[model samples]
Target: MKVSRLVALLIRRSPFRAMMLAALIAVCSVVFSLVSELSRVSTEGLDAAIFQDNGYLGTYSVSLAGVPLTIEDQFDVVDRAAESLDMSVWRYSEVLPEVESECPPFDQVGRRSLQVMWERPGVPAELDFGHIEGVNAEWCIDGQSIPKDALFAPSSDEEAIYGAQLYIDPAYANLVALSTTDPITYGFYVVSGREDDQVDALRFAVLDEVASLAEASGYAPSVVIGRVDSAEVNVRDAADGIALVYDLIRWGVLLLAGLALMTVQMLSARQRGWFQGLLIALGAGRARVVALVALDTAIVAVAGLVLAVITLGALSDPVASFAEQSLQVQARSLSATSLVPLGFGIASVAAIAAVGPALMVVRRDPLAVLEAPRD
Candidate 1:
């Protein structure tokens, strides 16, 4: 008999059994999809820690050997070091005193309120500020409260602003003009290079430059440097624990599904023995009967996979919302690559499950099975 025809006969005769097998496979696929999505989210978080916001892999601090350096001098030295080493650097000031602004909270800022001076190579120093979105207030500068209207009122060149009050969204306050000449003993620096493999060599190069600059200034400064990834290693270790748990859940599901498939196939074979025996007696080869059983299993697996795809598509929004609220990361969508494991697992289970039933049918004597008294 043709494979398709045999598959149709099996389903037509045992629609409920076929449905149960398909349902099992569908549940397995959904569980696998969720595991894949969570794995992707954890990977994203790891990447964020590995490469910080400005793309730097390591942070270094600089200080003089029992001496103080002006902020401008420290900035120039680091800037020159970055240029010479072909690296990128970011400068952050210790959180400065927050000034009153009219900008709404969470508008130009994130969940927390902060004010800091931020500088990067090739960029001017600027104020970084965040505030509560709903609260409104006038610009208070140097203890002077000024209305927005008077602050922007027309003025002559002689009345030019020593400092101007900026009004903008809290999330986008980077363009605001700010500069300081305060002296400091140490400077903070975040560095990034093109190749990760050269990080250690690059660190040595940066330290050499710092020493050279200090020598040029007739003072040797103590350069302090540390790898940022040390702390991140702890985070990666935690992710590993989470990944182990995910694996346990995934494999547990696959094992149960495989056992269920095997049980169903074995029981169905016993129930349909007379029909298979009759088919063999009607001139169907033993191998053909076995192939038909395997094909029926394959068809059910395919139907279950199709149902799983539809279910995942319908649940995408809810999954994303859950990920965002609980995991604090966006959920990844289903990809062909992600489904590869599910397809392979289903194929493997079907092949293994079909074996026992096919053997039972092919090994039995067709004459005896057909001539036996009805049970």
Candidate 2:
């Protein structure tokens, strides 16, 4: 029988089973490809957040190596680094509980208050909010000091900011024109998530750079870097998570590809023994006979791969967009280069599986198989 005819018959024997395996392969391919692309993009954005120590609000904690927090001595270096890295340096408000600062509490600052929508009046608002919407509610700070509490509708007016001590994001800091040394305390904690990890490395690099700069500037200063309770994430944790997930996916899909396709192919091969025996009887070489099976497997694999590619195209954007919104980071476009290895691997497995049964078929005797005299 011709190779094309054999392949057609092989497929016709169990079309749905073949299609089901193909679909499974496609689902695996799409998932792996999408995850790989997301990881690459997430890594890129997170790397900058780790090194620069500002922007991307989800960053659990930022590590500053050296140069001291809120110190005017290293302002030049900090400024230069900020310029070079194209990053904004954030200064934490020193107004912690029981700490007195000359630079008025955020409550004393120009109109910083919380606004929210309530069905009725007199719903006691929580003094401190875990949500940003708390910025709109009226709260009594300290004793008998309800700083400018008014029941007005939510408007985009600047008067909404009626509180005294808000976390000094870059914009708020700039608006106040506060000096770094004006008791406007900055908290530059060394984030050592993993000992000797990337996060630690970034912190060390910062320390080294500042030390070198201080020495060069003819100032051998005593600088101490300490840790604070900042409940933020380090980039290394994310990397570990991605690696663990990838490993799980790779093994799971490999098992599916092997068991599903290989088993189906083996069952189908049983029905084609007469056809294969005919080929060998008609002077077809073992290599040629095996090629026929490989070609048939290739056809199925190609179909699966195409389905996978199409599914990936359809899902990648939506998944990426969801991640970007959910995680609050830039979800870059999927990279084409990531698929090369995956495609090659799928093809290799299909070829190997096809050749397994072909080897058996090529050695069988056509006339004896047809006679069925021996079990």
Candidate 3:
């Protein structure tokens, strides 16, 4: 019989064992996949509630909704800052709504005006806004019924490192893009006042000043002071936790897969000692016997991995939904890239599991088995 058919026949010898092995593979695959996706969502989902690069401790944002037409007039309102308070500014000019969106925390920083153009989706998220950091305004979707399919920024992928790029789309609405050139935008003001009460008083004082200017200038100012979400709300700060999870997944999969496959294969090989002796006596080289044994284990490993992948595909969506609702994240993607490591891990474990069985079958003497009494 061909090695392939022979291997298949051998596996069929123990239906109960095969069933047990299949179950193990499926369960582990589901757990590993779900945990990984949850981790990604947890990290990415948080930013919509809070922003990165808060300018200074106790800093808060002051956004002016009804922006003046000319840049100089806009400057006039902010020129009246109290001597004790330090301030920085960024202006919004274009607000091409991706769907239904709100401002980002970084958009509150000042940058050089871009002498640029937007040819319909020209920029990838707040890209038109130059590099500036340390703002106090944090955005939240608390009350807004953000659509289920809304696309979000600070992408869940590796691209999140650079704070500039924003994923732009008209899916539903998760994030808003603000550039210095955007006309209907807020004036991001950085002001110092850590405590809520202190910031509230400062904001009220500014609003009062703007109201006073409105009476004299004939143009009423519309402004609101917003607070940046504090460190308490930040989720990414728990770097150690994420690292621990990754380590657990890696080690756990390796140890479980290796030991389980090795246990089964070694037991089967030791039981078939007389059969192995017959093959050797039939002129099959020790190396050939070992190769055949390794091939048998390889088939089992492939079967386990295949079962795992199929189960993952069937269940990823439901699992993602549960996670999304429970965790409240904007995204939960099961990227294909995550599988690369898993595949390698399985192969490594299978190879280690196959070795003991192959070595035992190869090293045993064919003549001794015939002379020995049957157990």
Candidate 4:
């Protein structure tokens, strides 16, 4: 029989069977796409949130003489360690509180010591005050560089450290009668400088702010700040979890669908007993029958793949948006890696479904098939 005629006969006689095969392949493709895209988004977002919040891909902290060492000291220690380890130093720092300002009060406060503290409880008491530190541009996390504009300039040399005190909660702000205009400051007595200038200087600067400079030196934080890194890690981990679960579900659905498709194919071939017997008697080999079945399956699989691609493209925005809101993190677009797996999975399912029935038909004896009833 001609290949075209065989295809036409299969399609006309088994339209529902063909549809079932196509639907299964399409579903497989969609599942693959979703899992791939979700995983990529989760991993990338996780890395970003971790790095941003912790100031390093990974963080570790060390204690020195029971007087918790500053991030700068940690960096120095790590740098020395890296040298021994044959690694290059990127940046280093030790914590030192520099004055943030000695200028006209942003708000008129009559007292010299207002006793400001960080609104968030449990932050190191010493760091609670408006102490600032000098940092490299790359190390700065939150603020833009202090412009040459006078409004942001430090009034004295002591205040040259660039930093910002974490903002107080609104409830606390109300309690202190501190309007947004009030110049809230944290206070930290100057400790020994880290390979820098005078420790006795009482001056202050406006650009002082907190930052992470030690990660560049190959050290992580001892404790993450505000659970920033933890949150990101959790989000990505959740995505991976979802992917695993969905993969199992996809396989289960495919198994059921495959069985149904295989059954239909076998029944249809049995109904063509006379034709199959004629082909066998005329010297048609089992290999030829197998090849024909494979071709039919391949065609259905291709159609399913095409349909799956279209469906996923249509759902991309909604999926991304849902992920972003649900994960509470940024979701990146689907990647090439994601698409490859999905396409392969769909093709595999199609081939498996088609081959099962084809093999069963090949096993039947030609004379018996010819003598069998058409139904």
What CA RMSD would candidate 3 show? Answer: 15.6
Q: Which 10 residues in a row give candidate 2 its minimum summed lDDT?
A: 113-122
Give the clash count for model 3: 9
Per-residue lDDT value at 220 in model 1: 52
RMSD of 2: 11.6
lDDT of each: 0.61, 0.52, 0.55, 0.47
Compare the candidates by lDDT and give the number of the best one. Answer: 1
Report the lDDT tens digits of candidate 3 across residue range 174-243.
2233322244342344445333334566466566656755666677677676554354423434544665
Q: Model 1, which residues run further than 4 Å from truth?
A: 46-228, 231-235, 325-327
Tens-digit per-residue lDDT, 140-176, candidate 4: 1122222111112122232213122222222233333
**Counted clashes in each candidate structure:** 9, 23, 9, 28
Which consecutive 10 residues in model 3 have the weakest lDDT in total? 112-121
Task: Please report, as a residue range, the 10-residue window in candidate 4 with the lowest summed lDDT.
Answer: 202-211
Which of candidates 3 and 4 reaches a greater TM-score?
3
lDDT of 2: 0.52
Instruction: Name the lDDT of candidate 4.
Output: 0.47
How much is the lDDT of residue 348 in candidate 3?
81
Higher-ranked by lDDT: 1 or 2: 1
